[model samples]
Each structure stands twice: as structure tokens, then as C-alpha cells.
Target: MSRSRKVTLRAHPHGPTPGWAEVDTPPPAPDSTAAAFFDVDNTMMQGASIYWFARGLAARNYFTTGDLIRFAWQQLRFRVLATERSGDMSQAREVALAFIEGWRVEDVQRLAEEIFDELMAPRIWAGTRRIAQRHLDAGERVWLVSAAPVEIGRVIAARLGLTGAMGTVAEVVDGSYTGRLVGDLMHGPAKAEAIIQLAAVEGLDLSRCTAYSDSANDLPMLSTVGRGVAINPDAVLLREARQRGWEVRDFRSGRRAVKIAVPSTAAAGLVAGAVTAGLALHRRRQRVS
Candidate 1:
């Protein structure tokens, strides 16, 4: 007999109404594999979604070239040191809102469509995509979790054909940007909470699912899954992952599934050249002697 799936929509106490569906828990299918959750930024790509936002804003002409220059400078300073300055985040929010303040929602979505193909697709990690495909091919659901605004996350979800996406919900009023976020930011524990809620609605058993990430900030969400994998994890996260016995994968090109060797492919060419030069010198010395 076929299993019935149920969906539930729950109201947000402090934010815009979020629609969610609750599923009646069902027995695992004979062919069903575990679901996989992915952290979108560093784990799946080389940088953060904010970087893409800068490009997106420029494409829409929402920001002047000068504005982009300022944004780039801030991005370089804050992210390089891995510091979360509240002032920086606030400033970022302000700039982001100003860019889309009066833009029609439809226009923004259309622009997202273009940005997804141009900026996001080619930059996505091949190993990450392979892992996502492995789960999908095994008949498991895939979710994209990020701290980016819901609208931006939705665009990425659509591009990847994912089952759903959970992200920070920026506040909007009367179909215009409100320059503030609604509810809790979808990060750390909030991310774990969202995943649990999503799983409950889909009748998914958390113990049978998997999650992948690259930072310690995602610990809560990663811990929620039965199998958590750390991909190209940061220093702190690498130690934590090892302690917790979590599966780990290196996303750099030509990197072995084991320890993160220097980014291969490009580095390999340099090594080969050095070895060839060393051999040539040794042969010349032998002939001279």
C-alpha cells in the first residue's frame, strides 16, 4: 500500500507567517535512502552567499560601482578574520535593504533566476553536487539550508530542484522591503529547530538523515541529523568533527576523500614542474662529472 504524506502550516509568533506541512510518520520504503541536508555557503562553494548578493545587486543596478567597492572592502575585512561584528551585520542588512527597497518582488525573483545560472551554478563544488546527487539518486530528499534571505535561498532551491529550503526571512511590508529580518536568524540552533520542524512535517525520521557543513556555527544543525559530515571544515570544526566521529569529505578539486591535501589539480602541475627541473639539473651534473 502507498503511504500518505501530510503537510502542516504553522504560524510565526514574531515574524511573517510561515507555511509548513506536517506529515504522518510512515515506515521507511524498501528502496528509501536517508535524506541529506546541505550547508550552502562554504561547504558547497568557495565563499558566502553575501558575495553573490553583491554581484546580484550590481547586476540589477541596485548599487552603484562605488557602493560595491565599499561592500567589497567590508566583506574582505570581516570575513577574513572570521569575526561576527554586530555592527557589520547591521550595516550589511541596511545596505541590502536599500538595494531592494522599492524593487517589485517579481523583478527580484526574475533577477535571482539569472543570478543562479550565472554566478552560483559553475561555482558550486563538484564533490558537494556529487554527494547531493547520490542521495537524490537513492530516493532521498535534499534540503538547502543557509542564513541568506528566504527569497535568495528559494532561487537556489529552484535551481537545484531541491525539495525545500529554509533560510533567514527578511521582513516585508505591503510588498516592499522593511529593512529588517523577521523571527530568529536561521543559524546555529535556529537552523536545527527549523530542520526538526521540517522533518516532522515530512514524516521524516531524523535518525535516518544526514547533514553536511564546514563550520562550527552549524554544529547544532549538524548534530540534529543521524549522520553529520564535515566538508572542508574549518580548524575548530575539524577537531570537533573528529572528536564526534563524524564523516568528513574534502571538497577541493582532485583532493582525496581523506585529509585535505593542498588544493590539487593546479598545485599538482607546480609539483610536477619542480620535479622535472630537479631531474634535469641532476642529469646535467652527472654529464659534467
Candidate 2:
């Protein structure tokens, strides 16, 4: 005969766990924390965060009119580029990283906040925001996980009034970016890894936590949590959700749906081409060094 062991779950300070008892699980462990991890792109905001930040820089003249045109082109490809082959995501992201080479870290943080308020504020989806708020009201810790720079993610989390966030942390030297990543960008398996590390540090119970995202790229992360929710899912993610019987929420189906306004595809294509070149050049420099 097998003996059963009991486990305990810790409730969030906001209130008692909602429907937690419905599940046949022991009480939470002492000091255990339940959290909600959210994806930043299509999952939260209607579009990509980098694009809006670039647009904000253009409007502020940080990037000249001509520079803005090129950047927009790159962002377009960044948004629509499909990754069929292995390492494709990494190669594509290297483009954005090259763009930020030699920028001061503090400057980026300050600018992200300004840009987020002016441009990103209006793009937040109410349905997704409601989910985040519900978790917050329940006193559960909430975090924004994305491949966008960490500073940008933190700003978004603060604005949303959540606990905190985690994102891609770029390598910095002498107060400026080195154009090299400190670790893997927070995507796919990397996101799951990040959450696992967080759980160890925060004493979170993965089986009692929740994760939300829209891209199939985030499947690894969604699978890591006990409850996975799909918001405004892309075709790939929607299919996976159906197969897994995961909960789905779509905020973009109605005529009143609003997303962040971006530039033309042609403009974004130009920017993508430039970014491709920039990545090649940056790689060459690294080889030479």
C-alpha cells in the first residue's frame, strides 16, 4: 500500500485563494507565494513594446525623421517575421539588441517610462488588464515576462500597479549597453527557466500559480504553471490552447478593438533590412575584437 503525504499552500495577502479549495490539494506550504506571470506583447498590450518605444523616440527627435523611417521598417519585420528554422528567434532578436548598443541604461529606463505613458498607455487591452487586476486584488504577486528589455518591463508592471516584473537583461559596461546579451532573451524555454528561478527564490508553488500569454512561443512558460490562459491568441497559440483545453479570452474580435498604431509595412521593412545589416556588422566587429 502507498502512503499519501499532505502539502500546504500559502494564500496571498489580498484575500483567501479563490476556488483553491475546489481543487483536491493540501494546504499551501508555509511562506509559499502564488503568482501570476503575464506576457507583455499581444498578451497585454495590443502590439509590441519595442515598436512603440521607437516611435516615441522618433517623435521626440531622438531618432531623426530618416532614422525613424528605417527603424519603423525594421520593427515591421520584427513584428511579422516568422521563425520556421531553429535559432531564427535569436537571430531576429539580435537585430533589436544591436540598435541599443552604447546606450546608457539609466537613460533607457527614464525614456521607457515617458514613452510608455505617452504611447503605450492607450494600447493596453481592458480585458487582459482586468485579469491582472483581479490577481492584484486577490493579493497575488504579478509579474510581466517578456523578451523586451528588463527596464521596459518593470515600467509596464509599475504602471499597471502589479508586484513587479522580469524581462531580457542586456549586458551593460561602463553604464552603457555592450550590444551583447547578458543571458538568453526571455522567450520560449528561457521564460520557463526564469520562472523556475523565481519560484526557488520566492518560495512559489508552480502547481498553484498561473501564467498568461498569446504567442505559441510562450507555450513552455504556459505549461509551467498550473493554470494557463490564452489572451488574444495568435493562430498557432489558439490551436494549441484548443488541444490542451486551456482557457481562452479574445479582446480583438470586436470592431471597437484598438491596438497601438504603428507605421506602414514598407517603412518597417526598411527598418528590418537595416537591422539585419546592423546585426551582421556588429557580429563582424565582435569577431575582429
lDDT minimum window of 10 residues, candidate 1: 263-272
lDDT of each: 0.67, 0.76
Predicted structure 2: lDDT: 0.76
lDDT of 1 by residue, 210-284 (tens): 999988889999999899999988778899999999988976644343222332222322222222233334335
Global Cα RMSD, each model: 18.7, 9.5
Error of 1 at 78 (Å): 7.0
Task: Give stretches of model 1 more than 4 Å off.
Answer: 1-34, 71-99, 253-289
On lDDT, the candidate that comes out on top is 2
TM-score to true structure, per model? 0.68, 0.75
